[model samples]
Target: MNTNFNKMMFFYTMMMGTLMSMSANNWLMIWIGMEISTTAIMPLIPNKNFLSSESTVKYFIIQSISSSMMMLGVLLLLINSKIEYQMILTSSMMMKMGVAPFHNWILEMTEGLELMTMFLILTFMKMAPLNMISYLTFKNNLFIILSLIMGSLFGLNQTSMRKMMCYSSIFNMGFIISSIQINSIWWTYLILYSMMLAMILYLMKKMKIYYINQMTLNENKMSLKMNIWLAMMAMGGMPPMIGFMLKLMVIQLMLINKEYLISTLMIMTSMLVMFYYLRMSFISIMFSSLMMKWSMWNTEKSSTWIIMFNLIAMPYIVMLKT
Candidate 1:
């Protein structure tokens, strides 16, 4: 009960911090909020392993460096507003978000985190920084290109599910950043991505799956296997899945803005991402172990509801598109 209370307090602190940052009227308030969120999340990162300890330390160090950079940018901007300072602030937020070139820390941290912690980092923790970025003016074309390239190429050789998802997060960050100018589209993409990621992570956690190969070990749970693979395909932005619609919205917006080059790059990298998602799905479906009992076939009600929502929601998205 005591431990649970402590965790709840930390979680509340983290949420308050993020809310403060998002609603702040000034740079200093934003910085304070970011610091609060960072400090609050530290205790929540450590779990039942040495890896979690290492991850907590690494997370602290990285967040500290980014926060310091943000402070410096804010001070300089107050002294004399310059585009360089603005760029510095933008870069710091990108670093905090684990955007590529500053992305290695996220991959390492994901390896050690519990599924819930990882989910928060990938989705909720990103909101404050993303909101701050939207208030800045920076040429994100280079960041977009680098994130897509690195996320696609690095993910291909990864067998760890967490690491692969980190790469996918990086790739999706490019689209998120691209859509930032259109607030509605940006929120839409973020919400869709969060839902898809949460579904995949929850399924993986329930099945005790840490790696791609582990997915094949669930011998008698075909329905569960199907759910995981379908979630992966959705995450990879396959057509008819809600993820594809989300990406298509971003791409359409980019084309309307005459960003043909970035749109083309996005499409190409998405295909590469789809390849790995398909590979994982194929492995899950084709390979099975003979070690589990037949009675393990029961699917959880929550998971079934999630899958049913995915199926039911896609048609509405299609209709909206038409």
Candidate 2:
């Protein structure tokens, strides 16, 4: 499945599709681009095992339905010349982005795929739909609130690392959408979230980790263990991290705009998410009491760069802000 040519083809084709969606001037081409990206990514979903194959099918069907809904919404707009159809279009794209309430497919799909592919799906595959979403008139505020609440509450008990991240993605999507109601903050949240997630993925890849149950924190060197912990903390949007700054900015925007109820809901739901992160961190520390060999941590040169980035990324961004 990792054939060089095939992988190259998938990468190129998906990029083409994403670029098409982003650059399209008209609605039709945008939808076409969306469909193309969807189709291109289907082959990339990794059908190497029975579970992966099932996940591929599930991914295909969910995407197809979401795309169809978007098309239907577009057609309604064309026929009726009504702003109401925009809601339909936006909701469909929200579903495509795995916003909560429509979030389970992404969780199931990520659970079934391998790590690199999961990273691709989580990051790259989301851009086109998100681009489309950003252009639509922003009236889906209720969906945004629901996505945050559901992502936080449901993620509380998740045992799998990937699933928790999926919920994290959903919760963050709410912030992304909320930022849409304001201006410019969405990009900040998205970039910081992606950066934090990239750090998590890098550590997991370096350690060949896919599950909480499979890997022990004590198995890695102390420094690397701390990186993973901090990465999780950052991803969970804890204080003194870049992710927290992103949330703080969003919250400030929300309060300034007098979205007091939304602000309160967000703050409360975020605590639920933070609780699970603490729970997971505690589990990792509790289970892995044995100290790993120090040599295991610095075995690769890449470790040096990731550690530097991990330690510096948030503080540097915070410094820039100041």
Candidate 3:
């Protein structure tokens, strides 16, 4: 009962804070909302077992620093009488979103967060801009570009699937941020990306993948190697997948906006990132043999079937839309 109470309180605080951050008219109010959210959840992270507790500590410290830095940015921006309240709010949002050089705190914070927590944080962070961008007057295309470039290149050799996904998520965030410069379609793009991510992470968790490398180890009776490879390929935005369609659509959006140089850079970086995905796939699928111990792996048949349906349906749905 106590656990349930804590969970409910955490959920309520986060939900309220998210709504407040999105709807607040001023920076001070948003800051308060963020603080409420932060404090409410900090205990939840540390209360978990083993590494999760350690991760929770690290996450709290890093987020505290980031929050301070963001507040500093807001104060600095506010010193200018010519800047509007919305301008200050936008700058704060950018810093919080970790778009680039402004993103100094994001990677470390991400490193400390557990996979499920990170996914939720990413989803929440993405929502802030969707609600706030309309009021922002400042554009930071350079920051967005830096985030994309760094996130893609740095994510190349991540051994842990969670870390890999975290960096990849950053890259995806960069694409969405860049799209904001192009049009309001950015919100739709972000929404679709978040939806896909939520589904993918949930499915991955259901498969008991605590790390990407675990996919190579056949603790389960099933041929995880092939399934893991398929999952990675889907994430790589390979053709005949929903991720591919999202990438193709966004890149075309970039091209149409005449961001030729940035577009080219994105394409090249995407290819580089794809190489790692293929590498993981090759190692997992090609090198590993199937396991014969079927009884040990007690994965739910119904859930697996549902995940399979979604995975297959995504591509067909895209084809229909196209």
Candidate 4:
């Protein structure tokens, strides 16, 4: 009971901090809110193992440096109000969000965390930094390009599911950063991404899947395999999926703004991301254990829900497009 209460408190603190940062009008308040969220999340990182301990320490060190940079940038902006100060602040927030070039830490750290904790890091923990980033006037095209390139290139060879998700998060961050100017599209992409990620992680956690190879071990569970692959395809922005529609909106927004080059780059890198998602999906569906005769036809309620959720957005996509 005490442990559960403690966890609840930490979650409460984290939520309050994120809300504070998102709602703050001033730089100081933003920085304070970030600090609160960072501190609150620290307690939740460690899970009594060597890897978790290492991840916690790394998370702390990186966050401390990011917070310091943010504070320095805020102070400089207050005094001089230069573009460079804004750049520094923007870079700091990007670092906090684990955008590429500052992204290796997130991959390593995620490998050590429990699925739920990693899910929070990938989704909710990003909210404050994204909100902070939206307030910045300068948007660095170079970071967006680098994020897409690195996220795609690095993810192609990864075997671990955790690391793959980290890379996907990085790639998606590029899209999110590009669409930051349009609040409606940005929030919609985020919400859809979060939902897809939640479903994938939940299924992975339930099935005890940590790597791509482990997926083939569950030979009899076709329903679970179908659920995972469908989620992956949705996340990879396959045509007709909600994710594809979300990306389409972002691309359309970019085109309207005359950012043809970035839009093209986003499309190319998305295909790269889709390659690995297809690879995983194929492995889950095509590969099987030696004991084929022992296979059982079983389905879970969660699997049904997942499939329904993936398709339910189809009508909305049509409405949005028209």
Candidate 5:
């Protein structure tokens, strides 16, 4: 194993911070953990060039501002614990996670990082904040609806794969927030979606792909190409995909509860997002030709464990039992 202290030390610190925040019994401890996580991740941001340095600076400014907002909200709660104050705290966490209007910093920051590092930011860094939001019983219908609308609409024209995925994450978080208001099943939904997302990013990392138009089916084996396309559809919540099932369940429950506006908006945004997903999918598929290549790029086979977990079976089985 490579013993790079810069990588190992910061990575472990990041994990430790996540655990601390998750297990903390009070908001103050959770804040400390979040700050630790924010500080730890900053050092890991790529700095081999000027753009990366810009990313690091933007990340620091955004995180510091969000952290301070979280702290202020918490302080107000301590002084006069009220639902109004709680909204401030929870909204700060949402800002930290880059839900919608607050999401630009992450887009800029992620654009400058290497793919693997960006993957970490997209998946792992948001975990603590997501859980914190879950714990807060946050149920802001307006914010959730806006996130879904803005995420879907903004992503319709994005060429950068990372930006598109970030917008998709914003859209997915709207469902997560909506679910928190409806049921406790967001945990399962989040797990299944996270795994599927990890699968897509892992493949993209191997391919060194950064743009939506760059995924040429001719460059990969038929099986791998189909799987990648399927993963993209899964992210978009196409029918039969685990993401689709999860969102369907959430929307159904919301409708039963008479949250018509949010549910209606959810459906609309989903249909719009699906358009871009199909566009990206078609671009990838149409590029296929019988071009012969005698050589392979990476001969290492994909991990069996990853393939197994990313399959729809896990969540589909849960849906079956439900």
Candidate 6:
């Protein structure tokens, strides 16, 4: 096949693999899906034009370890199958989803990848399915509590924006994982998190900035754009924004479920994380500068508008619904 055609094939294979993984009902099928997804993503990682080659190698090493662990756990589960096979299967899934002891590598690796890769792993893949899988098993499980505690603890002091979001994603995953105890209303939290993450990505893309220091309007005093800074504030989960509203709803949900201690811990983590968020937001928004005005570059204005609308409007919509 032609090189260009091969690249397309690889991308196609990745999508197919992801679809297969999501739809698979059996362990073997899920494993195949995972293998296909992993293989397909390998070639896409190495780029000659950017530092992505180094990132790719790091990603490969970490992901491969996790994938192998997941596969081994699944195989072990299969071998140990009994009348309670479904319970065994869920235990295996928990390992794959990076809950508890199996999750340490995930936290470490997310800090190593670039923003795009981090988004793909932690926010998109890791948080999303783990939310659902958390529901399929017992909440008080050792793995569940471990994931929650470590996720929150690690997220407390991240300075890098991408890494901070990565940890925030993990922290939020803890809350969502804890929600599995509720038996219902868990989907609401998942959906809210998904939407919040998408909006954050959108604002980041629109601003064409990555590092948290770049958005710091205070230190840069003479160099920051108002609109861009406002967008970053929204990303930090400020009031009147969808991110904030989603977080508030999650807190309320946790309280209703009588998860007072976990809720308190989560709130504390959020507040601790909020310091960086506020620092970033203040530098980006409140300290706007003429010298810092960012050019739109090749970004589509319509796309930015849509994202902005969602970030600003979703909270109001949720408030009205409640």
Clashes of each: 0, 0, 1, 0, 0, 3
- Poorest lDDT segment (10 consecutive residues) of candidate 6: 217-226
Give the C-alpha miss distance for residue 164 in model 4, angstroms: 0.3
Cα error, candidate 1, residue 44 (Å)? 0.6
Model 4 TM-score is 0.94
Instruction: Kindly list the per-residue Cα lDDT of model 5 for residues 87-198, writing each as its tens digit.
Output: 8877787788888768888888777887667767776887788777777765678779889998999999899988988898888888887877433577667777777778
- At residue 119, give the lDDT of candidate 2: 71
Between candidates 2 and 6, name the one with more favorable lDDT: 2
Give the TM-scores of the predictions, in the order they appear.
0.93, 0.89, 0.78, 0.94, 0.88, 0.71
Model 2: per-residue Cα lDDT over 1-322, one tens digit each = 4758877887788889889998998889998887887787777776566688888899888888988898888899778865578888887887888887788788877867876777777777777777777788767678878988889988887777888888888888888888784445676677667777887877777666776765554365555666676677777778776677778888887888898988898899888888887776665555665655443464345556655655577676666556
- The whole-model lDDT of each prediction reads 0.87, 0.77, 0.64, 0.86, 0.77, 0.57
| Top candidate when judged by lDDT against the true structure | 1
* Candidate 3 ranges beyond 4 A from true positions: 1-3, 47-54, 65-91, 102-112, 181-184, 203-208, 221-227, 291-322
**Model 4 residue pairs with clashes:** none
Task: Point out the higher-scoring one by TM-score: 1 or 4.
Answer: 4
Model 5 lDDT, full chain set: 0.77
Which window of ten consecutive residues has the lowest lDDT sum in model 4?
289-298
Please give the ranking of all candidate structures by lDDT, highest first, separated by commas.
Answer: 1, 4, 5, 2, 3, 6
lDDT tens digits, residue span 85-144, model 4? 888888888889899889988988987798878988888989989888888888678789
TM-score computed on alpha carbons, candidate 2: 0.89
Q: After TM-score superposition, what is the CA distance of residue 278 in candidate 6 from its true location, in Å?
A: 0.8
- Residue range 92-137, candidate 1, lDDT tens digits: 9989999999999999888889888899999999999999999988
Model 5 clashing-pair count = 0
